[model samples]
Target chain A: MAITGVLRPGHAQIRVLDLEEGVKFYRDVLGLVDMGRDSQGRHYFKAWDERDHHSVLIRQADKTGIDLFGFKVDSEATLEKFEKDLQAYGVTTKRIPAGEMMNTGERVQFTLNNGHAIELYADKKDVGNGLGYHNPKPWGPDAERGIAPTRLDHALLAGGDLDQALDIFVNVLGFYLVEEVVAPDGMKIAVWLSCSNKTHDIAFLRHAEDGKLHHVSFWLETWEKVLRAADIMSMNDVPVDIGPTRHGITRGATIYAWDRSGNRFETFSGGYPAYPDHAVITWPVEHLPEGLDYAQRKLHETFLTVFS
Target chain B: METQKGNTTSVMTEEAYEYVKITIAETGESFDCSTNESVLEGMRRLGKRGIPVGCRSGGCSVCKCQVVKGEYHQHRPMSTEYISKQELEENCVLTCCIKPKDNLEVKVIGKMHKNVCEK
Candidate 1:
């Protein structure tokens, strides 16, 4: 039986606010290039690597959550087979026609068993002309040449039922468990799952409220990039959520910042790989008791006054 | 079929006599659990602890697992309202309501990695 693709070899894709604004932030601020867009007006950007059409796709969305996550499968046939399999399971699957999006590759998409949307496609975009790195062009005092992001690292989402979502991703969708977090109140809060050796391609967060997309992360070429991104955010007066800290699981150094539209983004360096036989690890929520405390310090610093 | 003295249904099937071996990841040992018993009950009977079971009903997926190698059917229809059917096809079965018709190998799916101290 042909299994659905897991971590197909490629870069990450994202949906952004304004195409021009996103381009300015990624290209002018972060120093990336406009790889191009598809018929749907989705913008594609590339890093220093000149191997493909565009590693990142930023589409304009009216909303502020993650629109979808794309993973490359081994072959186009695998994509087709997954489409059939998903149909058999009564999942509503859609095939994006070539040229409809920035990447001309065919893609099959469906909402995950957990409500998060996912796309599996064949990426055939051109590895553009190799543009090497540029110098430390300072956009501000904090602006340093941001480290080039290698690929889409992972997306973090907050949902209500983590176990149900995890089962869908791990069992039905072919993703593997990296680790899980359970709070003291008997609530299973977050889960780290992946398709490849990298610790996790997607991390699910279960908060007290309704489920929503938390953030999307990209892998930086070096630790310097993470610092530089932090500096850029600080310089631009963007709200910094947390970070330049190391996660206990991925152990990667990360910097978290909000975009112009309040979407959270992270630039990180280094993470573990994912493997089939690797034992799934679990961490008690008590270890990090702040409760999804991305910015624990900030929460304690102030309280809301109704009129103010 | 008659009612048992304790108001329990006495309609037992030959399938109840069939032995189903369950391999719990925590214990790394396989135990002989009857087909009529839920996976959670089997674990409890064997004195296996730390499985993080809550809300014995399927409403809570704390007892979820990836059925690696067996054909255990759920006592009630599996609901995709909470988890998608695709996930169920991928071998995710809630142990609280599943009845094994054959030997099964299941890996715990949620929060199985929690530190023993937290449990």
Candidate 2:
């Protein structure tokens, strides 16, 4: 009950080059439950265990990157309150009418200092994870499918002026800093923030450009599943950026790969649960190689530069 | 017209297409690229890490390179943010989007450049 405003990561809208190719990869390879296409031709999907109608949306475009990332709020009142609060803090918010994104309620949209569009919404039609209310089953057929993840976990975004964006997420959105990576100059180059017990609900990396996407991560159950994800990626010839290794930062077991459109996604598991009372864990830039890849003890150049 | 001449599979049966030699200016590696095939596709088929795999389209800009000495045709538009007017004029293009028009030499300048050159 303590976790109120900005409950969890609700959805991320991505832009892909080919709609059908994206559908094949996300639905068949990644194992997300396809929620069908909208009137605007944007396809929607959700993790098998997620109760919400959809958490990932993709549309065909000339470019490849994320369009927006949204979070769910506790109630309609909380949504309105946050809008006013954000406005008071000199941030503008726009109300996108309900049904604009099918099953999703009206969204209060705003852009961060780093040029990423963020949304806050209070309502989404819960379709029940294929398990009825009373005496529901543990899992269904979808859970056993290709690289099936439990839920959309978090996203690491790349952009400049990350400190300003971090302040907005912490001070205004009711999130607390869970971990940070500091540069030689003592400025935080990367930050992980949390709204719930999860290690990070969303993270940011300082970069030269604005609105760059590092990766959108999905939560798997165990280390075995992370390895299975790698197998599936190899089977499908999906290009992997890094991992099937451990991150020294969150201690999460992960594998980073690209979708057909070049947008990066992660299949991850095993990060220490973070709470509001816990002190922020800091990683020095000097220790970043160990901080990024604990097993290899090497920092990858692609991890720093190649972002969509 | 699919003839297997050793390891190379020639699919240029119906059309009179020729393979152009492409040299990696950074690593001194060279590969045979078909005139109809994109430079990235050719290098990728080499089964080596000459250039990083990006979108295989023009969008990601991860496969960007400078045409140090080459004639290529850009089939798709590169992002203006990455390839500015001056950069484009300097023959900077995404390798995934350009097909070799003749024998060429290119410098790896993409974000993953170090992965190839340093190695």
- Tens digits of per-residue lDDT, candidate 2, A97-155, equal 99999899999999998889999999999998998789999999999788999999999
**What DockQ does predicted model 1 obtain?**
0.01
The residue-by-residue lDDT of candidate 1 on A94-199, one tens digit each, is 8888756655588788875455667777666665444323653333322223445656678887656677667766766688887777767766677888877777
Evaluated at residue A110, the lDDT of candidate 2 is 98
Per-candidate TM equals 0.60, 0.87
Cα error, candidate 1, residue A95 (Å): 1.6
Q: State residue A179's C-alpha deviation in candidate 1, in Å.
A: 1.1
Instruction: Report the C-alpha lDDT of model 1 over B51-98, residue by residue, as the tens digit.
Output: 445323343345567778878877533323233466677777657557
Real A-B contacts recovered, model 1 = 0.00
Say which candidate scores most in DockQ: 2
TM match of model 2 to true structure: 0.87
Worst 10 residues of 2 chain B by lDDT: B1-10
